[model samples]
Target: GGPRPLPGQEVSVKVLGALEDGGLGERDPRLIFVPGHGDVVQALELGVPTMQPGEVSFFLAAFPYAYGRPGREPDVPPEAPLLFEVTLLEVRDGPDPQSLPPAVRLRLGSQRRERGNFHFARGDFAAALRSYRLSLRALDGPATAPPGPEEEEELREQRVKCLNNCAAAELKLGRAEEALAACEAALRISPDNGRALLRRGQLLAEQGRDAEAALVLRRALELDPASKVIHTELSRLAKRQSPPS
Candidate 1:
């Protein structure tokens, strides 16, 4: 158990919160940010104020520090004992490193890909792909152009988006191998990426790796159980792998 938090600090936690009923409220082993830049509630504010990074706490909260009025939570009840188990992870700075402007200097190609976002969101798929490739080219180690802030952040952001779009386009174009490679690259950089997981599962199923496909699809489902497409894909895979009559 613990108390209070130092201001302007953020920590990741594995949280379990429950309402009046004995039923499980929210269960996720995934890490969550706490004192997370005012994104949480007042009760959370009260409890997390004294906690340090890597500390763990379990406690029941009272009404004043909990759902004080209506519209906060309809079912949690005024007098309910709100149980919580929390683990503080790392404290964060304003933005992630890449999001922060580079201190050293600047370059030209960086300016080019800074505008790539317009092309990407505009659905000019070919143009966006070209732009990301161009940005990556500028940053390729030595014997080429030097990189800059515009270059580095633009490359990081646009390359990720380009990879995702490539996977989608290839899938639409019936090129499963191309889609699979793009999705794999995206997943390597970001393991919990939703689109990559879905795309990879679809590609796996296309290649007749139905069992692997099912696993990927299931994970996607866990992330978003309300997704009809993922649910349908899982059903199709299950039907295909059923025992012979």
Candidate 2:
């Protein structure tokens, strides 16, 4: 057995999980995740970090740590505890987000963003926002060395996408200030990002900052001249600014 894993480090473990009745609940020969990232259940999140590579351990997880009150459908009953027999297979060095290569960041960032999208689609704005924020963290920091033109461009694009999605999720969660910040961050990455511009403009308008909203919306229209949504927003902004008319 090697050294135990630290937070942020990636771990690969083989898992054999059983329900309260000793019936099998889950079995995965190879499961990889970074601790504290919500990739695994809370019990595993707490258990795996204490294990050295090649070590095997058993953990008893309460309902809150496993599936919670609703439990897993058709198998694990509500409030049933679980017993997990896990083998720590490997531990990879955790990458510092700031020092990660652009390509690696892009890959990891894209995965988190996709996860965010899945949560968003399921109407879980809080979870979606969390995933989007994680994606943003992965994409944070510049390349330690020079990246290819394509890689740099791809990284910026992915960052913008995550920031925009973050804005969307934040808005759904009624965090207007946070949503506006996310829009601004996206615009900083890609100044001509239409989605970011539109969202920023809308948020500004909602806050009664008509002049700022108009400027941002005009730029958005220039980027997507045929966007009827932008056109509509522009019209609404004008009406608000048109005193008494």
Candidate 3:
């Protein structure tokens, strides 16, 4: 699910986009952006509007929203252009909470997750774990009522993220077995979850099970090759398996 962008919000966008072979603008935009405020995209109909700053993203965008339609842009040929490669480095929200919907109350968990991550960044492992767990507990309450299509989809996406984060927190706190369980549970919910697979691989390696770790991490790499952390861990695992000099 794509992240939402609110007004007064600034984000860094890395767009590997094209001019569609013909367009009026001389600019073929590329590089990061503190993107100006914008509306919800059709693709973002189920956006996780609670995205935080500094979170990296990679996505594909469908057009005519991606590019102006026929006669709109002289540079674009308008043969049904599609946009590939989009990265949102940061996402911000409006400061005033009253104007926001009640659903945002359910989004507090994400903010707690962010606090947990912040504590992790500061090397306060104990505090980080507390925050992560609290975040999970907060999100556990059953939905008040059945959600609309867009809302249900958004919640599912958020649920996966929460599970993945809890797993990471568990792993960091030396609860390898607990981490494994959390990751597995996440997989049960979303079998192809790359984050769960990646974390489980790390846990397996910590238990001195290199071969199994390699298998799990390899799958994660296939899903997200840009993960430097996973790549580095897999490299170490590979080196450990090499014959002695």
Pick the lDDT winner.
Answer: 2
Global lDDT of each model? 0.60, 0.86, 0.60
- Candidate 2's displacement at residue 16, Å, is 5.5
Overall local distance difference test of candidate 1: 0.60
Q: Which pairs of residues collide in candidate 1?
A: 3-50, 4-49, 4-50, 4-51, 5-49, 5-50, 12-89
Lowest lDDT 10-mer window, candidate 1? 97-106
Ranking by TM-score: 2, 3, 1
Q: Pairing residues by index, what is the TM-score of model 2?
A: 0.75
Q: For model 2, give the 10-residue run with minimal summed lDDT.
A: 115-124
| Cα lDDT for residue 153, candidate 3 | 63
Poorly placed runs, candidate 1 (over 4 Å): 1-128, 135-158
Residue 185 lDDT in candidate 3: 76
Model 1 clashing-pair count = 7
lDDT of 1 by residue, 1-245 (tens): 33344554555566777766775444446544335332333445556666776787775766444443331344555445567776665555432323333331123234435434434454444445555444444433342334575666555554455567667655555667977998888777666677889989988998999888988889988998899999999988888888989
